[model samples]
Target chain A: MGVGPSTKETSLHHFRDPLVDIVGSDSGIDLMGVLVFGSPEGNEEKIRCSRTAAVVAECCRPDGVIVETDGWGNLDVDYVNCVNEIGERGIPVAGLNWSGTAGTFVVDSPYLDNVVDFNKNPEGIESNIVGENNYTADDVRECVKRLKIAMLKKGMNK
Target chain B: MGVQEIDLRRLVIKSFHMTDVQMGDENKITMDGKLTIDGSYVKDLAERHSKVIEKIDIQIIQPGDHDRYTNTIMDIIPISTKVLGKCGEGITHTVTGVYVMPTGVDVDGEQAHEFGSSEGNLKDMLYLNRAGTPSDTDIIISFDITFKKGMGQERHAIIEAYHAVDEWIQVYREQMKKFNGNKATEKHEYHDVIRPGQKKVLIIKEMIAHGAMLDTWIFPNEPSGVAGGKSLIDYGCMPVMLTPNEFRDGAIHSMN
Candidate 1:
């Protein structure tokens, strides 16, 4: 059977922690709220954020839990309060800083910068972020190969 | 690699539909059908269908443009034995014409022409007629076509095509309704305006054609760099080219 949308989103969300680790703690990672833009059908913005969120979650496993609102107006204020409530227990509640519609929320560690820039330079991190550059076909092939190896390792570990 | 010669016989047309729903005081639904066929059809169908068939011509017109140039046509001569076995030996017959197009084209004319005294083999053209039951000595001919925009943009082109086909079909149906008398007018009107009997079959065929193009062309494949600059890569391999701010500004402009 085809995967439902929610399951797909969850699976995608699970993939981001590794990259988050590369960024290091001093950079201050902020989990953004849901990124919603464009016609719902086009989904260009949603896909970008979802992919970024998933990758960050994979890279930062155990360090942070990125929260994405289900949609605009669907955010649970009580849930935000609950995360804040947990912060009172001394747990770190990082809010992913996504832009567009659902950009506002409260969090323990808030990364004020927009999440969009990270999607562009997902690999590089530091005081200096590289400008946009087109990838050669070779670059893409290598990335795919790396992703495949990472996926295989993940499956074997599981 | 040079242009690859795909086995035409292996190709088939697949058909499907896209539905859009609108909510209001009363819900409204519209369904657009699609057709997909392999690129090989460009050569194979053109060859096979051309045999025993006379010719077909296609023209593209932009919106507000009155003139049209012939796009392409196929002519074919069929092997008689195939027709005898497939369509039966003793049937009134003539060459049947079939044309398929994406939803972008507005087909205006559908007619048949017979070569003088040439005993055209019917088998080759049998597929052209949906019924395949034509009386012997009768030139069984029809034209099926679609008019739609090229897969990308050309909104005006699609509108023009739709208007042209609509006008033509309307005229044909009216003539049929007149011939069948007033009693058949209502039924004929419904069939003609709402769903044209003859055009419906062609529309289905066009949907298959459109689907094939979408699958092969629109759907991204391994993102191989065109030209000699790069090798094969997966589709959507690149990051989103636009920044969020740029995108947001563009969205604001569109709304305005």
Candidate 2:
């Protein structure tokens, strides 16, 4: 929540993209492109980013969607909006974040229930430890697990 | 006759791998994969930034030696230089198996330019062998800078520190330019290609240039270097168009 360095610099080098390994191991799951979004500067920018992300995910035409954000607080406004926008389009979207009890979304939708909190800290709070609450392979697997159920529910709804 | 397309710009990057690093009489790369650096030149390097910098300590941290406590990390810079031609269209010599990390703190024991300082044991604070970090086998050249008591928060203080490190590395860059390209440990060639009657693709990369530590350097004379590069803030954070070959050649130096 209170990182000194830019997220662009810290996030890229501090963690391995688990998506690479997951795609290599599972043939049924064809990995799509990754969409990146930073903390928008203003409310307009936030809404724009959320809509753009949803539009991009729609273009990908996947069976399910997993949206991950490396931030909390005000950033969750766009995070939850992105999920809701995709969900409103009938896409089964799941959110990945470091929701350490206190890291709740500022604006949320019904789709927020499918969120996977990847907090590894014992205290379930933001710490100075770099990469402590980052998304891992286990978290990605859990998101996939929940996403499959959401997709099944959507199929039943249709 | 149909006009044939030719690749006008080609970049060749020659890499040399150094397995071991040590402080010695002079800076030189041996045939046995050992990089010997002259520690005596650090005093002269510190002299370049005497106003804001108090002292500069140059040390080589070997692989798996991450238990040692250190100051806040500023940046991890790759050692690369242009051996022939310009940045994107010519020959570049680079060092693999090693990276230069800059760490800093003020005289009053405050971490420099960091809001949430990562000042604990290195292993516990950093993820090793990531895209921008040192690999498991790579040695780390730690350039620890000590700023003046009240200068840690100033943007120029960190810039001077980086300039000192750049000057120190220029010594090695000059020597690397003279190495034989045939003996390079790795070689990669890239071309800037253009195709007509095809869909256009553009990659929009967003960078932070909100002033202070949130700045980025673009189009340095050397690959991934600070010299001759313009800061994104200096450009008013405008959209700068760059070729793919230029980008792949290390055009963007993230100061953040």
Candidate 3:
């Protein structure tokens, strides 16, 4: 997972914090540690970080994993690669990104599915309003549900 | 910082809508939604920066006229002025439906500003109506500034270009101060409040202040205007804290 700048307004919640809270509060889900990483400066480093993060997540032995990114464009390269690394290990994975219209995924993979685009702008672009197009409580809930379904299909109960 | 039980401050922004813009003998916004720019003032502004600025061509780009060619866009500036109090907490008067775009190139035709110059048709080069771009209904005031030979790559010369445009916009800023609050097309109020029982959150913004074309400015006199701001490079790239209202009020003026 990735975290970027705070939204413009103070009253709204950042996507990462609320998502963590929701997962932590759930009795059925055993939440692992959050992995906060910076944007790698080079392509080789980005790939290295992706594989390393996937290995760490696999060591925790979670039934399902959700990878999210707050940005698009070149950052998508690492985001998709990280998800692919996890999926290649036979782990179920989903994604969360801002790809509703203007930022539609430039690259995709068979390992990537059930992506939630939390864009709220009517024009489907970055409206600049604080928390307008960010992940909400409802979006987070949907992502959790998808993860549960993926686990259930694999005969694993969270 | 911990939360306290007090309202930090409040800011009220009043906006006047402008539908059209044209070059004329005087600089003023009419009551009927037209903005006229005095050509002589622009000529004088160019002369004032003669050491760095060689020639300036001002064009009034109508809405939807993005097929025309332009130099690399240096900045997209909003015209706003402080009517009362300071920047974060005060009455601000601003103009809507128009934006100022400063484009630059050297006398040798080398693009200034970005590492990769986006000098092409405005339509192809810009993603309009985005967070940092002009809307589809905006009237653009394009300041095409050609710098002296080899001056485009100089940090000080580029700063002078931005300063010159800021000075030119001051003419309209003065006019904005006189706009009646009741005549404003839109009004918004923002406040900085502390919620005691709520969880605390801090957002970190990463900015580039490496000299020569990549820099960020903070706390200009006017919203998104380039005058009276401190460069991040000068601050040694230290981390700065700002209240949410301050960020929404345009405290960070990105020069890249």
Candidate 4:
């Protein structure tokens, strides 16, 4: 759930605050906390390259983990690597999809076991995009909420 | 220490749009979106008052350059200026399409950053579709600097490194002051109207005050700006308050 310097959440905007803070609070479980990877503006891959995985593994050590990328493209590499590293710690992993292109959303990420796609839902809607008629912050909140539930179910093994 | 209301006008940032960039005989941005820079002119500026710098090299990187990378990034600066009074005051002009990033390493390839080092290909490192993500249509200027040996972690050495890069950015800060407000693509107005019944909120953002690589600056001349900014570490990482307008107007600058 950590953001990089590339996104306004990590740099300029405070959009991620309520969205991430909702994770442990909204569930009424007090079960999760989003870690800000805080990789520099460029060189986000360093999170995977560094021993940060060990740090994250030691920190969360959760029953499951949910990884969401606020922005699209190259950051997917960082998100997927982060999930892979967390999964290697013997944890089940789920992902929140931000990609809407033709191919390879969560499927592209090798380590993500389950994915929640708000856009794919017939009832689905936009979440965190900007411009004309972009998704509302409510849509993102719902999406993350769904991801937490999906990760919980995945951890339960049906 | 207590509540203070600084005029919101200080944070009014005026901006200019740059469509493209290139290297040429002089440092200038054209009306048709051409940014020309004589690299030597910038190198000369960096060499001054910084005994730690061995050499400075400038490179032009476009949206999709292949196999290109920069190590030890220090700052990502939006070229802008204060049209009147001090920084964070009056009219601040900014160039929207161009950004400057400074990079450096010690003589033995030691990075200038302390804790985490960002060293990788430029393309993969960047995140697109975000607020700060420069468009693929934007121009990037990489000021790659190499420093004297054993100075990578010295507080004064890092400050001098920032000084050298900031000197290079000063070139654009001066040029942007000439832009008229009519030519601006957009204007945003901010006001602090006291609503008697609304929920008053205060958010205390604890920024990094660690010296050397991990440091955050306050009230830079521009947003995420480096030049003429104060280090939080020097201030003992004390709690500082900023109004919403001040926060939006580039008052907090993070560097490594």
Tens digits of per-residue lDDT for model 2, B1-256:
4233335578888888888899998877753467887777887777768899988888899889888988877777777778888766789888888888888888998887544566678877766655556777888898988989877778887777777888887888888888888888999786665433221222223344434455567777777777898776676444455655566566767655
Q: Write model 4 residue lDDT over B159-207, tens digit each, in one string.
A: 7777776666677667767767777865645443233322121222323
Q: Which portions of model 3 show Cα errors greater than 4 Å? A: A1-158, B1-6
- Could you arrange the candidates by TM-score from highest to lowest? 2, 3, 4, 1
lDDT of 4 by residue, A24-102 (tens): 2332332322333322223433344323643454464455555554433444555566666655665555555444442
Calculate each model's fnat, 2 decimals.
0.00, 0.12, 0.00, 0.01
In model 2, what lDDT does residue B177 have?
85
lDDT digits (tens) for residues B1-256 of candidate 3 = 6445456678787788899899999888754578998888888888999999998999999988989898877767777788888766788877778878888899999988534465777876655554545678898899999999988889899988888988988888887888788888988786665445332222222334455656667777776667888785565444454554555556666565
Steric clash pairs (candidate 3)? none
Alpha-carbon shift of residue B147 in model 4 (angstroms)? 1.5
What DockQ class does candidate 2 belong to? incorrect
Instruction: Decide which is better by TM-score, 2 or 4.
Output: 2
Every model's Cα RMSD, please? Answer: 25.8, 7.0, 10.0, 12.1
The top-ranked prediction according to DockQ is 2
Best by TM-score: 2
CA deviation > 4 Å runs, candidate 1 = A1-70, A76-82, A99-158, B1-256
lDDT of 1 by residue, A40-69 (tens): 112343244334433433333322232322
Kindly give the stretch of ten consecutive residues in candidate 1 chain B with the minimal lDDT sum: B200-209
Each prediction's TM-score versus the true structure: 0.17, 0.68, 0.65, 0.60
**Stretches of candidate 4 above 4 Å error?**
A1-158, B1-11, B30-32, B85-89, B221-223
* Position A60, candidate 3: lDDT: 59
